[model samples]
Target: MESNILVIYTGGTIGMIQDPATEALTPFNFDALYKHIPILQNFNCRIDSYCFDPLIDSSNMNPSFWIKLAKV
Candidate 1:
């Protein structure tokens, strides 16, 4: 059977990348996810991602965030 994995990106250091031009860290655009993480292509199962709008910081997570996460 095929497996399905949902990668929930809640915005944190894990999704930050350094801008080569300015040397400043910025949020990575999930649209180019494969380019940044080629290893994902090796996975046999189907992998999908869901990024929270406005990207919540880990330090700022609250009950509302948990509710939203649970609904997903």
Candidate 2:
């Protein structure tokens, strides 16, 4: 049976990419994530992703984020 799963990116190396012009780490385009990781297509389930509107830095991780995550 196929299952649906939500993948939330909480901010980390996995969610960052080096900007070509400035060569600095920045929030990646979450919309294009599927294209970058085509392996997800092999799964027999549906996968969706959610990224923070104003991506939070890992240093600022706190209870608020956890509370929101729990609600989802």
Candidate 3:
């Protein structure tokens, strides 16, 4: 059976890379994450991602955000 994976990108240092010019560790674009980690292609699974707009600080997460995630 093929498993499915959902990568939820909120905001933090999980899969971030430093922008050499600005020296900022910004979040990697989830839509193009496969380009960075090609090994995902070999897996018997579906990989999808969801990004939070206006990116939350995680610490500021409220009940509505939790509800959105639960619905996913």
Candidate 4:
């Protein structure tokens, strides 16, 4: 049986990449996930992702984030 995994991106270092030009942090494109994480290509399960419209930084996380995540 194929398992399933849900990757919820709440936005933090895990989902950020530094822009070499400006040296600024930016949201990593989840669309090209395989390019970043080749290991996922070997997975034998379905992987789904949910990214917040406006990613909440780790420092800004609170109870509301958990509430919202639970709702999803």
Candidate 5:
């Protein structure tokens, strides 16, 4: 059976990459993420994400956000 997998990244370090030019860590572009990690394309499932417009700090997470995710 095929399953839809939702990978939620709350702007944590796990979802960032080091920009060699600027020596800074930036959010991975979910749209182009597969290009960077080609192995993901081999998966048999559909992968999707819901990201913040501007990454938010984990400490600032609010209930409204959870509610929004639940609706998705």
Candidate 6:
């Protein structure tokens, strides 16, 4: 049987990379996540991802965010 999994990335060090030009941290190319994490392809299932539009920092987490996350 095939399975479906949803991956939600809420902005963090895990989703960041160092910018070679500026030597600063920035959001990594989410589209290339599967390419970077090839282990995902090992699963016989469909994978999907969801990212926050504005991308919230962990320090700014709030109840509304939890609600929105729950909805997703």
lDDT of each: 0.87, 0.82, 0.84, 0.86, 0.81, 0.86
Lowest-lDDT window of 10 residues in candidate 5?
49-58
Q: After the best TM-score superposition of candidate 1, give how far the Cα of residue 36 lies from its true spot, in angstroms.
A: 1.3
Per-residue alpha-carbon lDDT of model 4 for 1-72, expressed as tens digits? 889988889888878888999999998888778787889889898777889988888889899888998998
Give the per-residue lDDT digits (tens) of candidate 1, residues 1-72.
Answer: 778888888999998899999999888887777788889888788777788898999999999899999998
User: Order the candidates by lDDT, highest first — what do you get?
Assistant: 1, 4, 6, 3, 2, 5
Q: What clash count does candidate 1 reach?
A: 0
What TM-score would each prediction reach against the true structure? Answer: 0.83, 0.75, 0.81, 0.77, 0.78, 0.78
Q: Which ranges of candidate 2 are over 4 A from the true structure? A: none
| Pairs with steric clashes in candidate 5 | none
Winner of 4 and 5 under TM-score: 5
Worst 10 residues of 2 by lDDT: 49-58
Task: Write one digit per residue (lDDT tens) for candidate 6, span 1-72.
Answer: 989988888888887889999999988777777797899888899888888888888999999999999999
Q: Give the C-alpha lDDT of model 1.
A: 0.87
lDDT per residue, candidate 3, 1-72, as tens digits?
999899888777786888889998988888887798899898899999988776778688899989987986
Between candidates 1 and 2, the one scoring higher on lDDT is: 1
lDDT of 2 at 6: 83
Q: 3-66, model 2: which lDDT tens digit per residue? A: 9988788778878899999999987777786797889889898888888776677799899888
Q: By TM-score, is 3 or 4 better?
A: 3
Candidates 2 and 3 compared by TM-score, better number? 3
Q: What is the C-alpha RMSD of each candidate to the true structure, in Å?
A: 1.4, 1.8, 1.6, 1.8, 1.7, 1.7
Model 4 TM-score is 0.77
Which predicted model would earn the best TM-score?
A: 1
Where does candidate 3 stray beyond 4 Å?
none
